[model samples]
Target: MQLEEIKETCPFCWSCIWLLVDPSFDQIYTEDCSVCCRPILVKTTISDNQITLTLAQEDDGF
Candidate 1:
């Protein structure tokens, strides 16, 4: 299975953003925060044909 895409609001400030996943499921990409213009770190994993996504503070030192 693959993480096709992410359709969720930004947890930081509730801004709408699109999180697209690569085919390899090793990386996630998204636009900068609309409210803060700050980058967002997206963490994801795929297992059993399911995708789990997590959004964290870009500067949270992942």
Candidate 2:
């Protein structure tokens, strides 16, 4: 699988950002914030061959 940074609109903050995507099974992968360089959590799913991604702050509980 290739790691690719894709441009996506932040669903929570409504901001534009780049997210890392592993082009297999459309799994949601999390990485340090590209803009703020902070930790984040990403949940993703695929339906109809379209990718849907959600981003949120990574809490210690997780």
Best prediction by lDDT: 1
The CA lDDT of each predicted structure is: 0.67, 0.65
Tens digits of lDDT, candidate 2, 2-62: 6667787554455678876765675545667656666667877767756777777767313
Candidate 1 segments whose C-alpha is farther than 4 A from its true place = 1-3, 28-31, 34-36
**Considering only N, C-alpha and C atoms within 3 Å, which residue pairs clash in candidate 1?**
none
Q: Residue 31, candidate 1: how far off, in angstroms?
A: 5.3
Error of 2 at 13 (Å): 8.0
Candidate 1 C-alpha lDDT tens digits along 1-62: 44366776776788777666654565555457667677777777767757777777777735
Which 10-residue window in model 1 sums to the lowest lDDT? 22-31
TM-score of 1: 0.64
User: What is the Cα root-mean-square deviation between model 2 and the actual structure?
Assistant: 3.4
